[model samples]
Every structure is written in structure tokens, then in C-alpha cells.
Target: MLTDYHVHCEFSDDSVYPMEDVVRDAIGLGLEEICFTDHVDYGIKVDWDSGEEIRWRNGEPFANVDYPRYFAKIADLQEKYGDRIRIRRGLELGVQSHTIDAYNRLTEKYPLDFAILSIHQVHDQEFWNGEFQEGRTQGEYNEEYYREMLRVVQSFKHYSVLGHMDLIVRYDKAGVYPFEKVKDLITEILKVVIADGKGIELNTSSVRYGLSDTQPSRDILRLYRELGGRIITLGSDSHRPDHLGAHIASSMELLKELGYEAFCTFENGRPVFHPL
Candidate 1:
């Protein structure tokens, strides 16, 4: 069945597409299932057009979702269209070392089918905006990024999969960070993830960004498989209708070439594998 496990809608601050519209578009594309993995980044400050901090309920300046509303919307959508398409409620949690407690509390409070733990920022510095790489050599940034990922994966256990394992490469201003530089650390992270029964997702946004590789790259996927990490999922990381289900077939073909016979989907935090 065709499924896209990483999608964002109005719930995510960066996405303008409404939930209903996203669903309708997915249906039009003949998708059998899709998971809404909206962003929930704590401790990261977002600036408005005027450069003002976005505050939350407690008046803390951070980017996070309204859990009550998010879950309610997902529940409503599930009830309304569960038969037509399997809508799974999920979150793409932007994790940091210091925010683990907050993330734990949030996850405990909500019932989620799937959760993607991602490092959108390290030490509160966002990679996308070039703040995370300022004054640091490419090697330093790459090492620190993977080290931070290792730290989080070792401590945080609430996620279903690691989203975009090589996400740092997408925003590195210096250029493509060599895989060999951080391969050992990434292997360690994958080992821990596999040991803890967690998995990783193949985010297809690389093509969208004009990159010539997947998020984690084909080498990382091969390494994960070599380490006995069988649990893997495919996601478009689509923030708009046109990007939805993009390049999923090519991703599947790549996985198949790497000897991956199936990909994973989640329901109530449990993984279900489907043939590729």
C-alpha cells in the first residue's frame, strides 16, 4: 500500500495547508495511509516577521504545539475518514538534551500512534538559519551534530523513529559533510536505536532541497541494515500538497536495492511492516 508517514499541515507552524485539505490531496493521489507528524519543538524560539518571540500558554518563548487541540483535531479527522484512509496521529519532536524532561511529560500526556525524534536544533541554535554553524569548522559542526544526536538517542526513548538521521547535512553551509567523518558515531546511534527497538525514517526531502541524496544518505541506510536494524519507514516530509508522496516510489526502490524487503508503519506506538 502507498503510505507517507511524514506529513505536516496547519498544525505545524511552517505549514499552511489545512488538515482537511491535506487529507483530500492525499486521497486524490491514491494514498492508502498517511501519518500527520506535525512539529513540536520545545526550547526553540521562533521569530515573527518583525522578529518578535512566539510565546506559548505559560508565556515561555518556544515553538510547540497545542497538544489538546492537535490531538482533538486528529481524533476528529480519524473518526471522519478512518475508513477512507488510515490517518495516524503523530508528532515530529524537535529534541535537545535539556528538553528531554519536557518531551517526556508531553508524550506521557498524549496518546500518539507514532513519534519522530529529530534534531532540528542543537544547543538551541538552528541549523537551517546558519546559527548552528557560525564560527565552527565543518568538521567541528559535523562532529558536534552527530555527538548531540547520540546523546539524545541514548537518553530519549519516547519516539517511534529518528527522523532524517543525517539532517545536519541538509543545512551545512560549508558544504556536504563527509559521511566518513561521522559514520562511526552514526553507527553507534543506530546501534542504540536498534537495541532499544526504535527505528529510523527515510525522509525524501533531499530532492526537494536539490540534494543528490536522501536525508541519511544511502550509505547510512546500508549501515543500519548491516547493524540488524530492520525497522525503517519512508516519509516525504511534505509541508505542502505538491510535495506529498513525492519520490516515495524511488525511495522504495532504493530500499529494495539495499535488500530491504519491507518498510514500517506505526499504530499506537507499535510498528507494522509492509512489503516494499
Candidate 2:
């Protein structure tokens, strides 16, 4: 009855869990269906020099990921658990606004059941490597981040859902670019995403890390709804087995309170609603 649209496996440069563990965890959590959206970022440019920390090393923006191996593993899991659980194959493609041609190559290679197009890198920089937090006024940094993210949404025509709307704010500890400062921009971003027929995700990763109530928060979600942004997916952005279905109850409650009657789920790449 519950589903998590975002999960990562060893194929991702950051995650280390084998596909079996991911499937096992999903089963344990009673997830009727779950999607393993492995990393599909190309040319993200990380510090490929010196002995980097494990988090940075394992999760450094880019990797020579084995796509064939990834698909094979997913196929194996799908067959292995076909009766007990519904395992959906998916990928989270990192988007760089200017690299549509490369992204086109990726789409050509892998036909995913679902695809999450995210702005993990901006201005040729990686946010996960902590590079996005480097010296700059917090306000300036967040504005720049959101602007780049909006550009990403506008430039790409692919992707089933927009992973996390205000993901850059996860780094804004000082409340610098407060929701108010980014309200208009957030509205515009949602307009573009909705107009393009893409969905937004209520990523619970922010809650797990104690960063914020949700990745985009109440204000943004409300704004999104008010602006006619309907399709919304819920994901933990889980990189490990234990994190599967991390905060569905809480996130669902938040969505209902925000006046949303349903959350979006996908079946064969089509949006379906599960009433909240």
C-alpha cells in the first residue's frame, strides 16, 4: 500500500548495499512497491585527487557506473521477488542544464520504468560533495542554487518527477534564503515543472538528517499546490536498506494538512494517485 520512489544501490557511486539487501529491506517494511533509482549522473566532476574521505570518495559526484550490471541486478531482483513484492526499476539522472545531449545518450541506453531528474550539480559543481556550501553569502548561494535548479527544470524535457524542489536549502542552516525570499521563485519553478507535465517529490531525506520538516517545507508545498502543481511523489532518497520507507507516515500527514488529498505513485511510468 506504500511505495518509495527513490532508492540507491551499489551501482550508485555513493551507495554500497547490494540489490538483495535493498529488496529485503523493502519487503520487511511492507512496501507493496518500491523503485531503485540508481545514480545516472555523467560528467559531474568531483575531486578525483588525493585520498578523499569515504563519503566523498564513495559519493563523489561522478563514477564509471556499470549500467548493464545495474539493469541485470534489477532484473534478477524483479524475478526473484516477483511474487512477494513489486520491484520497479528506475534511475535518478543528475541534470546539468547545458548537457542535454549527454542526457539524451543516457536515455537512449537505459529505458527506465521511472526516472527522477534532479539538480544535484549546478554551475558544473556537485552539491553532495559539500562543494555547494563553499564561501559565499548564504542568501546569494541559495538564490544561485534555486536559479540553477529552475534552469534545470526549464531546460530538460525528460524525467518523470523532480526529485526535491528546495534541496539547496538543506545546506542553508542559517535560514538565509528564507522561504519568503524564495517564494516567487518557487512558484515559478513549480509552474514550469507542472507545465512540463513533471511531478515533484516530497523527499524525506531532510527529516532523516534533521535538516528541515521536508526538503521543500510546508510553505513551498502549499505554494506548489496553489499554483496547480498536482503530481507529487514521496521518496526517502534512501541509499541504504534501513532507510527504506523512512518517513511515509509523517510525510503523508504533512501532505494532508497542506490540503493535498493524494500522493502520486507510478505504474508503468504513468502517474496514479493514492488518496491521503
Candidate 3:
């Protein structure tokens, strides 16, 4: 079955695509299942109904999903269109080491089907704006990024998988860092995740982003398999209509080629694997 495990809609701080329109688009595109993994960066962004001011990045308002409204809309859509498509509630949780308690509180209150634990910002500094990379050499930044990922994976256990496990490469101005340099850290992270019975996400946005490496990089995936980490997921990481369901088939093909037997979807926080 065709599925896009990572999706965003109007609820996400960085996206403006309404939930209804995204659902219709996914159904029209012949997708069997989709999880709305909208953004939630607690420390840097406020909740939509937090009664505080909303922040904007480059003129786009950034706020965490208004959970009450977001889930109600999802439930309504599920009842209305359950026969046509399977819709699952998910969040792309951007976590920092200091914000684990906040995430635990928020997640405990919801019935999320899936959650992508991502390190979008470390020490409250974002890589896209060069805040995290500034005042540091490429090696310094890259090492720091892996260190952060390892720390989160070791400490946080609420998420289903690590989102774009190697996302730092997307913003590395010095070009792709050598995997061998940080292979030990990456391996340790994967080991901890596998031990914790968690998985990693294959975010296909790398293709549209024109990234030379896969979202988590090929080496990471291979290493996951080598470490006997079998629970992997496929996601387009879509924020717009055109981005929805992109590269899914090719990603499956790639996974099969890499000897990964299955990809996965989630329901109630448990993985349901599908042949690659």
C-alpha cells in the first residue's frame, strides 16, 4: 500500500496547507494511509492557544499545533472519510535535551499514533539560519550535531523514530561531512534506538531539497540494518500539496535494493510493517 508517513498541514507552524485540502489531495493521489506529522518545537515556538504572541520566521507565523482543534478536525475527517483513506494523528516533535520534560507532558496528554523525534534545534539554535553552525568549524558543528542526536536518543523514549537522523547535512555549508568521522556516534545512536525498540525515518524531502545524500544518509540506513535495526518508516515530509507522496515508490525500491525487507506505519504507537 502507498503511504506517506510524514505529512504536514495547516496545523504545522511552517506550513499553510489546510487539513481538508491535504486529505483530499492524498486520497486523489491514491495514497492508502497518511500521518499528519506536523511541527512542534516547544521551546522556540509557542502553542497556538497558549494565549501568548505567536512568532514568525521570514513572515510565516510559527506556532505549535492547537492540539484540541487539530485532533478534533482529524477525528471529524476520519469519521467522514474513513472509508476512502486511513488518517493517523502524528507530530514531528523537534526536541532539545532541556525540553524533554515538556515533550513528555504534551505527548502524555494526547493519543498520537506516531511521533518523529527530531533535533531541529540544539541549544535553542537553528541550523537553517546558521545560528548553530556559526562561530564553529564544519567539523565542530557536525560533531556537535551527532552528539546532540546521541544525547536525545539516549534520554528521550517517547518517539517512534528519529526523523531525518542526519538532518544537519541539509544545512552544512561546508558540504557533506564524512560519515567515517562520526560513524561511531551514529552507530551508538542507532544501537540505543534499536535497544529501545524504536525506528528511524526515511525522509524523502532530501530529493526535493536537492540534497546529495539521503535525509539520514545511505550510510546511516546501512548501519541501521547492520545493527539489526529493522523498524524503518517512509515519509515524504510534505508541507505543501506538490510535496505530498513524492518519491515514495522510488524510496521503496531503494529500500528493497538495500536489503531492507519492510517499511512501517504506526497505529497507537506500535509499528505495522509492510514489505519494501
Candidate 4:
């Protein structure tokens, strides 16, 4: 079964596609299931050290989320497409070290099938928010970035899966942060993720970005397997129709090569595996 867990519809601020269209595309791709993990980013604080190069807005980050309407639409899709495909209600909550209370509240209030906890912004500056530009050395930038990600993983423990472990490298056009060089940092992050019993997602979006084969690289995948990190999920992280199942075949092959015999899916907060 092809299960793409991390996807966004118009409900997410950065995506413009409607939920119905997203469901249609998934069915066309021959996927068995797709989960709509729309953005739930909240809380923004400016960092003075980031200086003038940084230009962005700050507020209750996902203040636009209309919970009543959001859940209503999800219910509509569930009834309309119930026989064809499995549509799971999910959310991608942007979390920092201090946002644990808020994160817990949102999770508690919802009947989510899965929750993808992510670290999008760091040290009061959003990674994609234009605060950190492309000129800095990858080592210097990724070190700081990974450190904050580790802090987020350590602080927030309620999530079912860690979304895109190395997503900070999304904008590293230079490809300077080789996985071998940062093996120690990556290992530390993976240890915490596994120790906390959180699953890791193999987000295929990195292929579109022209970066490493997978978000965490082959080395990280191998390490996860070696460390007994059993719960793994696969996703296209698709926002548009055409990209619904992007690079998924290659991602599965990578997992097989890394010694993983199966990939995972969630229902009512319990994981089910599909054998390779």
C-alpha cells in the first residue's frame, strides 16, 4: 500500500490547492491512502541578532486556521470518498522548545489520526522566512540549525512522528553539509527521536529540491535502522496535484537498501506496517 502521510491543502498558508483536488490527485496516483497534514504554525518572536537582512511578519503564526470549518471539510471528504481511498485527518504543528504547552493543547482537542511535529523556525527566525540567507557556510549554518532541531525533539514529546528531520538543508543550494561530516549531530538527533519512541518520516520532497536522495541521507537511514528505530513513514510532502507521489519509488528502494523490511502507517494512533 502507498501511504503518503505528509500533505497540505489550501488550509495551509503556503499551499493554494483545495482539499478535494488533492484527494482526486491521490486517487489518480493509485495511492491507497493520503493524510492531510495542514500547517498549524503559531507563535513568532523576532531575534535582534538576525539583523536587518531578516524581513518577515510575526503573529499567532497559524492564526488563520478555522478549526470548525477545517474539520467540517475533512468530514465531507471522508463521506464523499470513503469507498475509494482512506483520508486521514492530520496536522503538522510547528514547534519550538517553548511551545510544548500550546502543542499539547491542540493535540488534546483534536481527534487526529497522526501528528507531524516539525521545527520550521529556529531561534526566533523562520528558516524559510528570509532571515537566514544563502551566503553562510553550510557547516556554520547547519550546526546551529541541527542544534535547535535537537532541542525541539528533546523538549516536545507528544508527537507521533518527527517531520523531515533534515529539512533545514532545504535551502542549502550549495550542498555543503555532507552527512558524513555531521554524523555525530545527526546520530544525537536520531537517538533522541528513537529514545522518545517517535517515528521518522522519509519525506520525498527533498528530491524536488535537488538535494540528497532522502531528507536525512542514506547514512542517517542506516543509522536509524542500526539503532532499532523501527517506526518509519513515507510521504511525498506534496502540495500540488502533479507531485502527489513524487519520488516515492526511489524512496522505497532507499529504505530497502538501508535494511528496513517494512514501512509504517497509523490509524487511531497505532502503527501498522506494510511489508516490502
Best by lDDT: 3
Q: Which digits, one per residue and each the tens of the lDDT, describe model 4 over residues 55-148? A: 3334322343456677899899999998999988888888877777877877788778888888887655677744764555768778877787
Model 2 residue 22 CA deviation in Å: 0.9
The residue-by-residue lDDT of candidate 2 on 229-271, one tens digit each, is 8889889999886688999778888898899999887766778
* Clash-forming residue pairs, model 2: none
Name the TM-score of candidate 2. Answer: 0.89
lDDT by residue for model 3 (1-276), tens: 899999999888778899999999999999999999988997899887788999787788878888999999999999989999999999999999889998999999997899999999989999999999999999999999989888888888999999999999999989999999999999999999999999999999999999997888889999999999999999999999999999999999999988899999999999999987
Of 1 and 4, the candidate ahead on lDDT is 1
Worst 10 residues of 2 by lDDT: 46-55
Q: Estimate TM-scores for all models.
A: 0.94, 0.89, 0.98, 0.88
Better of 1 and 4 by TM-score: 1
Give the Cα RMSD of candidate 3. 1.0
Model 3, residue 128: C-alpha shift (Å) = 0.5
In candidate 3, what residue range of length 10 has the lowest lDDT sum?
55-64
